[model samples]
Target: MGDGKSSPNPSSDGEEEVRREMPAKKKVVVVMGATGAGKSKLAIDLASYLPCPIEIVNADSMQVYQGLDVLTNKVPLSERQGVPHHLLGTVAASEEFTSKDFRDLAIAIIDDILARDRVPVIVGGTNYYIQALVSPFLVDDVVDDITACSLNSSRELKSVDSCAGYERLKEIDPVAANRIHPNDHRKINRYLSLYESSGVPPSSLFQGEAAKKWGRADCLRYDCCFIWVDAALPVLDRFVDQRVDCMIAGGLLNEVHEIYKPNADYTRGLRQAIGVREFEEFFRYYFSNTMADGTCVCGNCSAYNSEDGTPSSINEYEEALEPNFLEILNSNDNNLKVLLCESIDKLKANTRKLVRRQKRRLNQLKKYFGWDLHNVDATEALLSMPCCLL
Candidate 1:
């Protein structure tokens, strides 16, 4: 929805003048938490009662891509009410929208909101995008391998000898090598390239740039208020289960089929969404195991293929199959039930993992910008006005 411009009335000339002279503080509200933690709902609720108009800027990476609204857990139109939302489902599913892209777009949108005298509410679970917007992406943070190379083409950077490269980096840029895990060949390559292109080490570049910028490595690029909406793990787990069930009922599998293609670009873009990849295996198995009319052809029908095409014969995948896997597959109703249950469990597990990672990111954010953070229990916050100051 487009933002509604508030026109001034001559009758309220005094109030308008005061507002124009002393505009509201230009700060953005960042509601961050795990999936199914009700971050979006909290933003809508807060905006509903705020004295000033508020606009929601989407920060969830998946929601930016067009389609898969149900899978991405986008707020339904009926629920959004009349509040204007920006950056949700604005990009095509085929395209990739990175955190850098989000940072640029969001900054511009936030500026417009401030110009319109409306508060910008940034809400989502994608911690990286929010982090990018809040902090500056220093040039030293990203070491270009090509720029690091002295020659026209450095084949060593692209060599399969990853171990030798790690050793080489340790000899040249010991600080960079120590910061990077020995097993991480990609980072090793980047450090090696930086050394080859320039005699200086990555540590020196970072320290030099950091000293020039804010006397430290990290600095806030935007003044923001971080609201961490948190809930108990058990409560969140139940919510995750219910959300997965709802997505299934909402035809999430059909939505998956719409964009599901063999050898598709699953590593990038909307296809990387958890639901899309997790369900791809089940959908493929379901289609192949069943007939054109949905008749079961396999006896137990318990065996299923994973994303890697490895067959698992039980509720969980194991190197050794159960002795009665064949017998179980032959079972009538129980076989189908088990397969469906396993698929659902996989979805729940993946979602839970995502939430755990997001929660951990909170600690990092708190450490980086602790003074700016104000966390609240989501359940308690929902009952009362979370941000009365806004």
Candidate 2:
């Protein structure tokens, strides 16, 4: 998230005025894909071909939080090309934002856009947020209590033993525990909330008819069409690799350090975003020369060095990190390079996992909510989705 209030494209004011004069289309087009697959570009380009003026509604959960702009991959305002965008970098990073919160706010935003007679194009990689908007699967009837439980859990989890909450979740909902990673605090908290609010575990609830029942007919709020920006796995892998390199080059570490609050648990709020947690080890290395969580391993070696700044090259990193290399019997420049390379490799690995999860969710959309997705090859330039889709 960034510091200031979110801005609309200043160049689009005149066109937006004209758009307000037209009749409401009351229609929606949703763009979904893995990160770095050009979902934002597709949304911006798709707006141009639509007969009615289309305003973008962001569905990406990370981008909704303010600051960490580069890590979140916020579409540069210049790239917006005079199209109005909503909900980009609107929440502070310290705040807790959830899919249900997005769904309610998006509903109101869509209504406002419809009243102004403009089209709303929903774009983001967060399929969960999109699902909340298009389906009643997470209706307020259920979410209100869940939200209360979440607040209670947030408070309770902090004071009690950390593992206690996770253990309780496993004891009550082992099926959910099996599905969720032990380290994933967000899912643990959510599963616990579900148990607390509903007095039923997710495994049984998921198997119930109510959870299984969802369709287009249930979406009485607005008509929806989903466009999936598709790319081959090899192509996506290349894109992800290039994107990871760019993010690191663009000072993603600095950004992470700036917003990172120590002791911030991933189970609550925006800290769970990939870069913030992934760079924990790197940040420790940067701030404290010793790799051992601020503990100096060497008894006689000086722990502090003037070369504590961000290293531009492997040589610089090697020189700055020498003190921390005392543990290695025959530490050399090559050894330090290998350690640094491991950090980058870890970042790339985490990013690939995120991309795979996103694609898996996209594949399961139809199965979960009966959403028929139109596929678009994003690598092709000058491509346009069929505007006739409603």
lDDT of 2 by residue, 42-102 (tens): 8898867999898999998889988888788888787788888898999877777777689
Residues 1-390 of candidate 1: C-alpha lDDT, one tens digit per residue: 237755456468677687699645457788998887788877988876778899999999889989998888788777786778999999998775666678889999999998999989999988767866776653334555335445633545554465687778878778666444344444566566666666558666556555345212235665577888888787777677777877776667557756766456565578878877676565555545542333334323234453433344333322222222233334674645477567668889989988888887777667644535677776543333322111
Candidate 1 lDDT score at position 162? 53
Worst 10 residues of 2 by lDDT: 381-390
Question: What is the total number of backbone clashes in candidate 1?
Answer: 5
lDDT of each: 0.67, 0.67
lDDT at 89 for candidate 1?
Answer: 92
In order, how many clashes per candidate?
5, 5
Clashing pairs in 1: 148-197, 299-329, 299-330, 300-329, 300-330
